[model samples]
Target: MASFKTVMKSGHPPTLFAAFLYFDFCFAIWVLNGAMGPFITETYKLTPAQTGFMISLPILAGAIMRFPLGILAQYIGRKNAAITEMSVIILAMIYGFFFVSSYNDVLAMGVLLGIAGASFGVALSLGSGWFPPEHKGLAMGIAGAGNSGTVLAVLFAPPLAQAYGWQAVYGFAGAVMVIPLIVMIILAKEPPDSEHQSFKEHISCLFTKDGWAFSLIYVITFGGFIGLSNFLPTFFYEQFAVTKVEAGRLTMLAAFMGSGIRIVGGYFADRIGGIAVLSVVLLAAIGSFLALTSTPSLAVTTILFMLCFAALGAGNGALFQLVPLRYPTNTAVSGSMIGEIGALGGAILPNVMGFSKQYTGAFATGFVVYAVFAAVVLGCLFLWQKKWVGAWVGPRGKVIDPTPAQLQAAGRLEPIAA
Candidate 1:
């Protein structure tokens, strides 16, 4: 194992830091509505279903926008793409501050927030691009830990909303956006890892079975993380009758666990293998989900959520550790495609939970359904890895040079070579 200092020496650390800050701030903005959900619901007199839809709009829009931004980043450069997106996000925040007067306008603001959410692929790719393959997991994990921006949103937004009104928080968010934008301009550089590819090659991952397989797993990992992170404040407020600020605080505890553990996940994935780590985390997520169906006490529920989030975060890191191995040249584009699909699953989760509570009188049904879906994906992972192991990766999803026997088994070696 390499020392942290050694790993830092291996990559462009300033660019990595810039990417982390960029992603962190963008993530805080992306889930701003979720952090302020109780206030928004009160202002609009929203039904459970309406609250779900309102919270989900940004996620859906962001997912749809990610791939396009990734393609643009390929042409214009990731650094430039990030700068452009943040510029738009700041303007959108200004719009939210002055113009969002009614439910319809709030919905429009949600779409605007999607612009912030589109930062995922470019941020991870840019941060890890300078590192060698062995260390990419840790690099990506550090960059990916920017999802901790959820903690910032949940921790600060509610109090700010309470003090100055929910809409005014947008202005505050826009003000803070300047900090990251400045850092990105001064510190980040376009990574040298990129290759100029034609449009068809850039889009090729979209057509592969492995790409879709990765998307399905991410649906459980990142999808679950973003979805539940957005919904948790609302869940605590309504389910346990906690105050809105308290709800946000409790959600912070869970989000914090998820964000912090991501780095650990990536580090271990680099050593033991991403597949091994992913398998453990997935089972842990499944167990946590199943346990949540019983509707325990407030403390118990928070702890369960924290455990679930930790598993999801670790799964996220573990999965991405394998992504570069699978799609070395097209990391940004392939990541965006996977992220796009995975985030669509995020859009689905809140609506499911909301409707479950409204029509069926319990959130347990939603938990059960998601757990089942995760189980199925786990089965698929086991099935898919059999082909993956000797083909492109070693056992447990480590990068490897295929042995002659392995190459022959994969039918890649010529007769003489075999």
Candidate 2:
């Protein structure tokens, strides 16, 4: 593994920093409604189910948009793709502030905010492309840590909404987005040799067994991470009877812890192995989810949720670390595919919790289901390691080249050299 200075020398720092800022602000805006969920419910007099859908629309819309944005990043450039996303956010903010009046109006704004959510692939492409292979995990993790922007939303949005109404939150987000937009325009650039690929090339990379496997694994890690991030505010409000601002403050702490730990996760992935890190995190998540099912006190629930999020953050870094190693030549497309599929979990989990609460009068059923799923995913990961240890694992435990036979068995026609 590279030292911090060595890793720093491997990529253009200004661009990487800009990528982090871009992703940070995008994420803050993407889940703004989640932070404002309690307030929105009060204002709109929405049912639990309605509140769930409100938080979900942006997540689902973002998932839907990520694939195309990934493709677009290749065609235009990651920087350009990000610029376009920011432009949409500005427009969306204007609409949200001036035109939105009803629940449906807020729902429509969520769809537009989905463009901000779509920046996941673009930011990853921008930050990871500039870094050396051995350091990509750390690079991507730092960039992905922009997810800590959720802290900004949850910590501040509710207070602002309380002071000025939910519409004010959008205006504030728009203002905050401007700083990153400017920095990105000035500092971010496409890495050299990032030539566009044909649709067929992308398809060949995306439509494979390994591709789907990565997607499923990402769904659990990133999906669970983001799903819980968006829903925690609602969970806190309903389960604890906290005011919106207090709920935001608690969720803010959890989001900050989770997002910051991702960098450590990435660094460890470079040193140990992505699969190794992922194994530990999935196991931790399974335990945490199971704990949640017990419906412990607020303090216990908060601690358990924080522990779960910390593991998810680490798993996210570890998962992307494997991507460049397994599909070096197709990282952009494969990352996009995995990211898009994984992100759909964000939309799905909130609905699960909401419906569970509505019908079961509690959230234990949803927690149990997620825990079972995490355990199943962990089992599959262990089996995968057993199957491809030689080809995919280096003698020193880093990613290495796979043999032709190994490539074929993994559903790839060619092996990407390490």
Candidate 3:
């Protein structure tokens, strides 16, 4: 509460509020196909693999677009970059609403929707740059809370599709986009002192160890959260013989846990440290995924899924909290690259679930695979903590403010080219 007050005290409330709305509505469109999976699948007679690939296209497309969007945010400014991104989404929704008549048409729409997903770096930077470092975790968490848009999609899209046809969902999405567009025009502004690093320097981050590490972690955390959210409707529908609307209702509960509680995750990351919070989160995820391996009853599966989403949601907050601290001078670039890389999880995980089902007649193998991978990452993060402890203010318990020479010596700083 105090941190939030401190954040609001130092930043523009209108800009932050606009950033949240921009992210919220865009996110709803970003995952729309997943929410409408049953309708789309039934309409196209899509196989499990095709359905997985179709839902994953937007994620893959977003990943491909994010690096450029990240750089664009640096050059054009986050606000302008956001405007461009939203416009694409609106137009794509319009096309989906009126003209999408074939499977290929739907795939094209997914590519355009990737622009909305690419908004992550720009949207976060738009709000996060307005605040001081100490308040960054909570500020970003509050902004990132926009992920809750998943709940709205799952809750509304299925019923809307049932009543008005799945394609009508796009028209509604386009209409909603108008709300954020107007608000962004009225309120979104670049922070006065926000850094704008060179594109070459931003790209150079991809070669660094920290860059790769963050991306890998996000792959598991965000990938698991979003991938699972996207896949859950399908999982429930296929496994339990639930109606599309019923599956959506179930998926909404889990998505809500992941998206809504993320702010609390950031609060703890600010207090006890991001790495600390992530440590607990990853461990919990490992346990939950492992539990899912045993073919639990629907009741137990729901509990396990909720726990996994909770951990991933909180882990998302904690991870981003560490981002600015680790690469303070390159927040947008690092965030963009890390976000882009981590998003591969969204692209990859669903396919894994699909293939697992394709061959094994069950999704347990995918759960086990994720659990094993997360365990390996947990160990890596454990070692990373000791090395980064003296470098971060929140994690180290005091601001060390190490000199450039010291930072370089610790291998925690990269030389930016002029």
Give the candidate number with the greatest lDDT. Answer: 1
Model 3 C-alpha lDDT versus the unseen true structure: 0.83
How does candidate 1 fare on TM-score? 0.96
Local distance difference test scores for all models: 0.92, 0.84, 0.83
Kindly report which residue stretches of model 2 are placed more than 4 angstroms away from their true locations once superposed.
Answer: 392-397, 401-418
Question: Comparing candidate 1 with candidate 3, which one achieves the higher lDDT?
Answer: 1
Candidate 3 residue 90 Cα shift, in angstroms, is 0.6
Q: Give the RMSD in angstroms, all C-alphas superposed, for model 3.
A: 2.6
**Deviation (Å) of 267 in candidate 3:** 0.9
Let me know the TM-score candidate 2 reaches against the reference structure. 0.94
- Stretches of candidate 3 off by over 4 Å are 1-3, 392-418
Looking at candidate 1, the ten consecutive residues that score lowest on lDDT are 409-418
**lDDT over C-alpha atoms for residue 321 of model 3:** 83
Candidate 1 residues 1-418, lDDT tens each?
A: 6999999999999999999999999999999999999999999899999999999999999999999999999999999999999999999999999999999999999999999999999999999999998999999999999999999999999999999999999999999999999999999999998888889778777877788889999999999999999999999999999999999999999999999999888988888889999999999999999999999999999999999999999988988898887777788998899999999999999999999999998899999999999999998899989978867787898768655565333312222212
Q: How well is each residue in 315-390 modelled by candidate 2, as lDDT tens digits?
A: 8888887776666655666777788889898898988899999999999988888888888888888777774467
Q: What is the lDDT of residue 252 in candidate 3?
A: 90
lDDT at position 167, candidate 2: 93
- How large an RMSD does model 1 have? 3.9
Could you tell me the TM-score of candidate 3?
Answer: 0.94
